[model samples]
Structures are given as C-alpha cells and as structure tokens.
Target: MPCRDLPPPPPPAHLRGWLDEAVVRADRARFLSDLGRRSLGVGRLLLLWAVAAVFVLGWSFIGMAWMAFEQHDPFGYVYGLILAVLGAGVLIPAGFWVARGARRDRQVRHLLHAWGESDRDPVADARVRAPGRSLTWLVTSLVLGAFGLWVAFAAAVSARPGDTTYGEVAYTMGIGQILWITGLLGLAKAAAHYRWAVRTFRAPAP
Candidate 1:
C-alpha cells in the first residue's frame, strides 16, 4: 500500500557552476606546474651553453698566447687580434656574465601547481628558502673553470715566439682553451644545479 501525498520531491539543484570552477582551477595548476618545470629546464640549458662557449673561447686564447712564445714567427696580425680583442673582450666578459645570472635567479618553487591561482597552493606556507646553495656552486665552479682556461691559454702563449706557424698554432690553442673552459664551467654549473635540485626537491620522509 502506498502512502499518498508527501509533497513532490524537491527539484534537483544545478551543479554546473561548481563543476566549472573546479575544472578551471585544476587546469591552471597544471599550467603553472608545466611553466615552472620549463623555466628550470631553460635555465639549466643556458648554464651549459655558456660553459661550452667559455671553453671554446679559452682554447682559442691559449693557442694565441702560446704562439707568442714561439720564435718561429714574430708578432703577426694573429697575435694582435687575439691579445687585443676576442680573448680580452668577448670570452672573459661572457664567462663572468653568465655566472652572475646563474647565481641570481636560483629559487625553489614550493608548489608549481598553484601558478594560476592568487593563493591556492596547498603548501604555500611550507616554502623553504634556499640561499647560497646555488651561489656557492656558481662561484667555486666559475673560478675553477676560468682558472683552468687561463692555464691552458698561458701554456700555449709561453711557447717560443717567432715560430713560423705561430699564428696558426696560437689560433688553434686559443679556441681550444675557450671551448674547454666553457665545458668545465658548464659542468660545475650542472653539478650545482643537481645539488640544489636534490636539496630543494628532496623526497618527504615516510
């Protein structure tokens, strides 16, 4: 037997607005996370490119300097070019400049997922500020890398001056030095990045 007339069932409430809001939020979070990841990747690549560039430049400088010592040739146009311009002007400044930037922009994003929101990151309060970790690596690594380049360049330059092939030799040596210096510097940066990454993104203890 059916009980007759309770009132008709309440009309169903609409949920489209709530659903849309949730979807939008999730999409924004994903986008931010992606950007954060991309920024990290780009920074890393730049650091490496800068390093390689330095090494190549250093190698060239070394070759030129070595030619200075060689007696096979006199101070030719080659000597003036390297000593005057590319070595002093380009590679040296480039090395220091890149290193400076690397040191400056190091940071750990506490929650990349909240990139879209004003203040919705789940762990917004848990951000751990990392200081000096990157700078330490940058300074130490850049110095070593730069020094290595200088040594390589100096070696080539100290070769007997006036070697007939001094021009060619010097050019080769300088280019090699620059490339090597850059590589070494880049390696140091990579190592530092790895270290920082390890620290910043350390897995939570169980």
Candidate 2:
C-alpha cells in the first residue's frame, strides 16, 4: 500500500477545481509503472525472437543462395541474395530499437517508484488491458504451430531417402523454425491475456 503523504511541492495548476493532486499523481504513477513493467517484459521477449528470426531466416536465405549458384539459376541466386541482405540488415536497427525501448521502460519504472506509490491493482488493470476474446488468435497459433511441425518433419524425413540436398533441407527447416517460433510466441501471449481476462472478469466470491 502507498502512503497517503503528499510528497514535496504542489502539482501544476490548469484549474484548481479538480481532486487532490497527490492522489491523482499516485494513481497515474502506479498505472504507468505497471504498464512499463509489462511492456519491458514483452520487449525483451520480442528482442530475443527478432534475433532468432534474423539468424534462422537469414541462414535459410544464404542456403538458398548457395543452392541457386550450384543449380546455375541467376535469378534465384539474386533473389536469395536480396532477401538475405534485407533480413540481416534489419537486425542492426532492431537491436537499437529494442535496447532503447527497454531502457526507457526501465527508467519509467524507476522514476515512478521514486515518485512515491508504485503498487498496481492487477484486477482493475487487467479489465482494461486484457482482450475481450483471444480464442481466434489461439486457434490460429495452434494451426500455424501444427503446420510448422509438419514442415520440419517433412524436411527431416526427406534426408532419409537422400533425395534432397543439404541446402534444400536447411531452407525448409529454417522456414519451419520461423513458423514454430512465431506460433509459440503468439500462443503464449494470447493464452496469458485470455487467462488474465478470465481471472479479472470472474464474479467475486460471496
């Protein structure tokens, strides 16, 4: 619980006909702190996912480029090169963006805590933040995950017959990895939000 003490100087005056400034400041700080923490967590996970995607997808394109040269397909090789460059190019800016956002969120959390009152009402926050319905997203994630699994299985099984080259295997496996990662991330987020929604909306015990 936050102390009801009025910390320091008075709040700004646009109009003095409003409620207590300290209470308003405390409430806003608590809400922003909560929001910052949640965003920070998601941002970290997203950064990891982004790095993983760059590697998986970038390697797959490299493999395609190699295969294209071996097959003497100029267009395919060029296309692969372009995609590989684009995919890898994004990582530099993406790294900077995530890092900057994470830093800002951390600063917000720290500042809010120092400004007196950081405790948040989870149930009330959930009512505002949680989705109304996430079932559709959940189902979509499941389908994507299943498809990714099938893709990976097919790629792995093809090696047993020695019919497909290593490059082909790498390309397909990379695609599968991308899809699998996306699906798992989506499912996790959607399920968590749905759970929060249920918990927040449930009737109070008698």
For model 1, how does the per-residue alpha-carbon lDDT over 153-201 read when each residue is reduced to its tens digit? 7657766755537666557555555545555655565564455445545
lDDT of 1 at 21: 58
Deviation from native of the Cα of residue 157 in model 1, angstroms: 18
Write one digit per residue (lDDT tens) for candidate 2, span 66-149. 666556577877776786676567646655765765575455434434332322345444433435334545666678777887
Worst 10 residues of 1 by lDDT: 1-10
After superposition, which runs of candidate 2 have C-alpha atoms over 4 Å from their true positions?
A: 1-60, 68-87, 91-132, 160-162
What C-alpha lDDT, on a 0 to 100 scale, does residue 204 get in candidate 2?
Answer: 54
TM-score of candidate 2 relative to the true fold: 0.51
For model 1, the stretches where C-alpha displacement exceeds 4 angstroms are 1-39, 72-78, 81-84, 107-206
lDDT (CA) for every model shown?
A: 0.49, 0.57
Cand. 1 Cα-lDDT = 0.49
